[model samples]
Target: MTEIVFTPIGTVHSPFSDPRDMPIQPVGARGVRGTIELDPACAAGLQDLAGFSRIIVLYHFHRSNGYSLEVVPFLDKTPRGVFATRAPRRPNAIGISMLRLIAVDGATLTVEDVDILDGTPVLDIKPYVPAFDAYPDERAGWLTTTSGAARTMRSDDRFC
Candidate 1:
């Protein structure tokens, strides 16, 4: 397999300095505010992003050390396939979040409902178009059973 490489287009700035006690998912982090500082070289790409109310942010989990095929997720007690959980530790150490776009100024973006940690390297940003991104009737697998727990769950040392 060929190796893939990505350059950070920006960095996320949030109140979360430590993983512990932070919301495990965006649903749990609702109303949390943060900022994205896009590289000046990529500032031009922000041209029409303001028109969108939300965006999909792909980022690197820089602080995650290793991976496990199975993990006891924050939302459940039973060990589940890592792919089934949104745990930070993974083979790629990558994470994605859909955050509300509050405002766009030059190379900076003020966002809400942020679950990402501070200083996270952002790989890509795409507008969240409901028509193309929302799945109103899709099955959520195990998530359907434990999603309620996610709303009040917080990160711990388990995955760290």
Candidate 2:
């Protein structure tokens, strides 16, 4: 296998220091505020990011220790294949969330609807254009049946 590496552009600062009570998804984190403290070296990349209302954040699941091929996700009781659930314990330990962009101040970004944990390393950020990221008719498999549970669900120690 080929080796790959990444350097985080920033770190997320959120109200959630512990995963036990955190939102399972962005929808559940509505109105929650957070900040991204970008490294000074990456400050120039923020130049045009303020124009977008939403941004997609790709980050490292820093605290997730290992992987499980199957997991009982926070929103469901049945164990499912890891790939089928949004459980953070994965081979890559990467996570993505689309958050509301509130403001950009030099190397710092103020955002809302943040579901990420505090101090999570941000791998990358991209403007969220609905035309490219949205697919209202897309099938979500098992999620189609259990997604409603996400609204009231919170992260637990199961995946920790």
Candidate 3:
């Protein structure tokens, strides 16, 4: 067996103190503002990061307590494998989102369209280049019909 660990490089500050009724995804959180208060020791890493218009944030799902092999995702009535849905309860409890970058001041990052919770620990940050990250023709699998629902769906206690 092997063990892996990660230390957060920063903490995300957002309006969401509670998970219930929050936007389920970035599309649903359009215009929502947030910031990352990065650890001062990592401030030097921000060099050249401001040039990116969008950044991919990788954070920990700190509030999620445990794992479930299957779950009834907030968007669907049928049960789905944990890996297929973006349910927070998982083996690793990691989360990722693409946020619109507004500015970078020292170790602080201003971002928008954030669906993450306040005080969430940010594990990593990466520039979001559409040429490498986007898949215009990707399949939606079980969410084919309900894909657009994310634009308005809110979070609930289903995964909690």
Candidate 4:
């Protein structure tokens, strides 16, 4: 396989200073607030972003140390393949969260519903359009069994 590299355009800041204290997913992070500080060169890309109610942030889980083919995710007790869950200990340490846009000033974005760790490297941001991104009925695989438990779920160092 060929190697690839990515340079972060910004960092995510949230109350989650420790990986163990962060929300595992957006469903568990409602009302939490955070911000993104983009590099000056990426400031211009923030244009027209304020109009979107929600934005998808693609970031790197810089704190995650290694990969595991199988993991016991937050919601379930059984171990499953890494790709089957949103566990952070993947071959590629990346994370994505959909946050509500509160405001944007230059390249700084104040957002809510944050699930990522503080100082996480941001790879990209995309506006979340309901028309294009939302689906009324979707199958969640094994996650279906623990869907109701997510409201209080938070991440831990197991995957970090």
Q: Candidate 2: list runs displaced more than 4 Å.
A: none
Which pairs of residues collide in model 3? none
Of 3 and 4, the candidate ranking higher by TM-score: 3
In order of appearance, the predictions have TM-scores of 0.97, 0.98, 0.98, 0.97
Which wins on TM-score, candidate 1 or candidate 3? 3
Q: What lDDT is obtained when candidate 4 is compared to the true structure?
A: 0.91
Candidate 1 C-alpha lDDT tens digits along 31-115: 9999999999999999999999999999999999989999988888899999998889999999999999999999999999999
Whole-model alpha-carbon lDDT for candidate 3: 0.94
Quote the lDDT for 134 in model 3.
Answer: 96
Which ranges in model 4 have alpha carbons more than 4 Å from their true place?
A: none
| Ranking of models by TM-score | 3, 2, 1, 4
Q: Give lDDT tens digits, candidate 4, residues 1-160.
A: 9999999999999998888866788978999999999998999999999999999999998988889999999999999999998899899998888899999998899999998888899999999999999986999899887987887987766875
Output the TM-score of candidate 3.
0.98
Q: List, residue by residue over 50-118, the lDDT tens digit for candidate 2.
A: 999999999999999989999888877889999998899999999999999999999999999999999
Cα TM-score of candidate 4: 0.97
Off by over 4 Å in 1: none
